[model samples]
Target: MPIITVTNHVGPTYALEPRAPTAASATLFRNFIQWNVVNAVDGYVVQHIQRNEKYWVQRHFPRHQTYQAVSVDDYWECWRVTVAAGVTTITPARDLINDKFTVVTVMDAPGADGTVGRFPDKTGTRGRWKLRGLVYFVADPGLVIADWPAGGAPSAGLLHSRLLPPIQGNGLARNRQGRLGGVLFRREFAGSWDWTTEDQRIAPRADDGVGAPPLVTYRDPVVSARNFPALAGFRSRNIRTADEAAGGWLPIARRPAHG
Candidate 1:
C-alpha cells in the first residue's frame, strides 16, 4: 500500500513603506519581502495553518521602520511514498525559515512482527516530533453485497434485512463541503441518508432501488418511523454521531509548540 505524504508551504509577505527619508529606505519600502517557508507539520498544526502562519509572520518580521503589514499564504505538495528497496531516504531540503532540514526515511516493508514502525524526526532545538504511518482499509463493494440476499428478502426466521453498501470510492477522502482542509487522501460520499418506514419494508420492491443500494457510507441517519405506521419487529440502528460520520486523518508530524 502506498502512503501519501504532504508538504506544507507557508509563505509570508511583508509589506513595507518607508518611514525614513533615505533613497535606500524608499527603494526597500517600494516592494514587499516574501519568504517561502515549508514545514512538514502534521494534520493538527495544519488544521490551524492560517493562525500558525500569522504567528510565524509576527515572530519573524516584527514592526520595523519600513514595515507596514504582513500576510501569509499556504500551499501543499503531495507525493506517494514509494521505494524499490526496503527503505527510502529523503535528503536535506532548504527553506527560508529553516536553512536546511532533513526528512526521515520511510520503510517499504512492515516489521518482522507485522507492525508498522514509527519514525521520528527532530528539527531545530525546540521540540521533538514523530511521524506515524497510516493505512486505510477500503471495503470491497462486491464482498459487502455478496452476503446480502437477492431481492432484499429476509432469510428464514428473520424479520427484516437492510443492505448497506460501501460508500468509499476511488475519489479523494474529502469532506462533504468538498474541501480537503489538511487531508491528502481521495474524496468519498459524505451525504446524509433519510431512512423512512418505506426503507424498512420486509421485502422492498425491485423498483425501490433496494437491489442496488446507494453508494453511501457514514451517512447521518434521519429515521422518520414515527410519521408512518411502524412494524412490531422492525427496529432501526442508532443514528451515527458527527465524529463517527466524519472520518479522521493523521498528518505527517505535528509542529512543535514554541517554547
Candidate 2:
C-alpha cells in the first residue's frame, strides 16, 4: 500500500505529524471504528475523527500505554498492554513487551518514529522506520464539518516534503478545518515497493509538473467507501466548512477527521 504523509504546520516552532494509513488499510479498519462510534454523536461526527486520526497516525508516533490498557494502536491494528508498576514511562519504549504490544517512551522517542507500534505486526521490511513526531489540534465545534487517509515512515520535519508551500495570508484564510486552502496530498514510494515490484508497478502517463505526459503509467486501485461502515450514513454538507476548493472536497464527498 502507498503511504501518504501530511503535516499540520504551526508557526515555525511546532507541527503535527499523524500516522499515515493507506486508503486500503483504512477501508479495512473502518468497520472497527464504526462499530465503536455507533452509539456516539451523529455517525457523521464519529466518522470525522476516525478518518482524521488515520492521517494523524502516519506522521506521529504511537501513543504509549499509560498504565496498561488495550488500545487501537494504528488504523489497522489494536493492541493490549500491561505496564510494569512504577515504570510511569510517559510513552512506551519502542520494544516488544510480553509478546504483545510495543512500548514507546517519550524521553527517547517522539514524532512518528516507531513502526513496530504503528501498525500491528509491522516488523516486515515494508514497515521499518527510524524517527517519529507529532502536533496537536483542537477542532472548532462549528467546523466539526467533514473528514479524509496513508504510508511510509518519514523522518521528523520532513512530512511536508511533498506538500506545496502554504499560501500566506492573515488569520485563518480557510475555516477552522482548513477548508478554503489548496493543500495537495501526495504519495511517494522509496527504494523497493512494498506490495509490488519496480517493474510491475504501474504509473499512468499523467502530465508531469512540466506539462508533458510522462512515459510511465501505473494503475492504482480505487478504495471504495462501501468497505467502510463509518461512512454508511455520512453526508457532504454536514462536514463542509467553506465553498472554495470543491475539487479537494470530492474525497470529502467521498471521508472524518479527529481533533
Candidate 3:
C-alpha cells in the first residue's frame, strides 16, 4: 500500500511579544506559538486530504468500493512537527523564531481502494494497476497572520481560516484543466480577525519582511507531486498483472477428517 505523505513547510519565521523575563521563558513562549501553528496547519492539511479522498472514491474507484473508514491504526501515521534551530533574543521590540523549516504529515490507509488498491478491477484476463493523483495550491504570500495576547494564549480562531471546499468534477479535474476552479487557498484573516480594533496591535504576518511587526507565513508554495510535468509521468505508468496485484494472500489450510 502506498502511503500518502503531505509535507508542509510553514513559517521559518514567528512573531511574539518580547515580554519574557528569562531566555528559558522566551523559549517556552515560542514553543507555545510553534505548537499552535503546527496544529492549525495540520488541521488544514487533514481537511484537504479528506476532501481529496472523497472526490477520488466517487470519481475514480469502482462503484462497489466505498470510502474506506478510518481506523485507529490509520492514526498511527506519524505526524512530526519540528522547529528549526535559532537563537532566541529579546531586543526591546519583539522576539522572533526565524529558521526556515518543514512539517511532515503521513497518512497510511491500508486496504483502501482509492488510496492503496488497484483502481479498476481486472476484467477476465485483463490486467489492472494502482493509480493515484496529486495537486498543489500556492496560496498568496503574507496572507496568514496571528494575534498573540500579551498575558494569555492566542485564540484558536485567530489561527484558523474558513474550510476550503473540495474541488468538484472528475478526479484530477482541476489539474487536467490547469485551474483552481475559483477555490481560494488563503487564511481568512479578514473574516476571522477583528480588524477594527486589532489592526494596530502587535501581530505576526506570514512573510520574509524584516523590521516590520513579525509574522508567520508559509514561505513555500503548496504543490502536488502529480502536477504538470509529473502529471504526464503519473498517467503513463506501466500496468501490473493480476498475479502481481494479488500480493501475499494465501489459501486457507484445512485438516482432513477420517470418515
Runs in model 1 with CA error above 4 Å? 1-68, 90-259
Which pairs of residues collide in model 1? Answer: 42-253, 171-186, 171-187, 172-186, 172-187, 173-185, 173-186, 173-187
- Alpha-carbon lDDT, every model: 0.20, 0.19, 0.20
Tens digits of per-residue lDDT, candidate 3, 1-259, equal 1112222334222222233453221110111111123212211111121111111111111322222211110110001122234322211111332111111111222222222332221111111111221222322221221211121111111222222222323112333432223322221100000101222234445463433432222222222221122222222112222222222111112111112
Candidate 2, residue 200: Cα displacement in angstroms equals 34
Q: Give the number of the best model, judged by TM-score.
A: 3
Reference-based TM-score, model 2: 0.15
Name the regions of candidate 2 deviating beyond 4 angstroms: 1-128, 142-145, 149-259
lDDT of 2: 0.19
lDDT of 3 at 79: 17
Error of 3 at 41 (Å): 14
Residue-pair clashes, model 2: 46
TM-score of every candidate: 0.17, 0.15, 0.18
**Root-mean-square deviation of candidate 2:** 22.1
Local accuracy of candidate 1 as per-residue lDDT tens digits, 1-259: 2233333343111122233543222110011111221232112111111100000101111221111111111111221211234443221223412111111111111122322223221111111111111112211121222332332321101211122322323122233422223333321111111211132324434676624333222222231111212232111112222211111111123222222
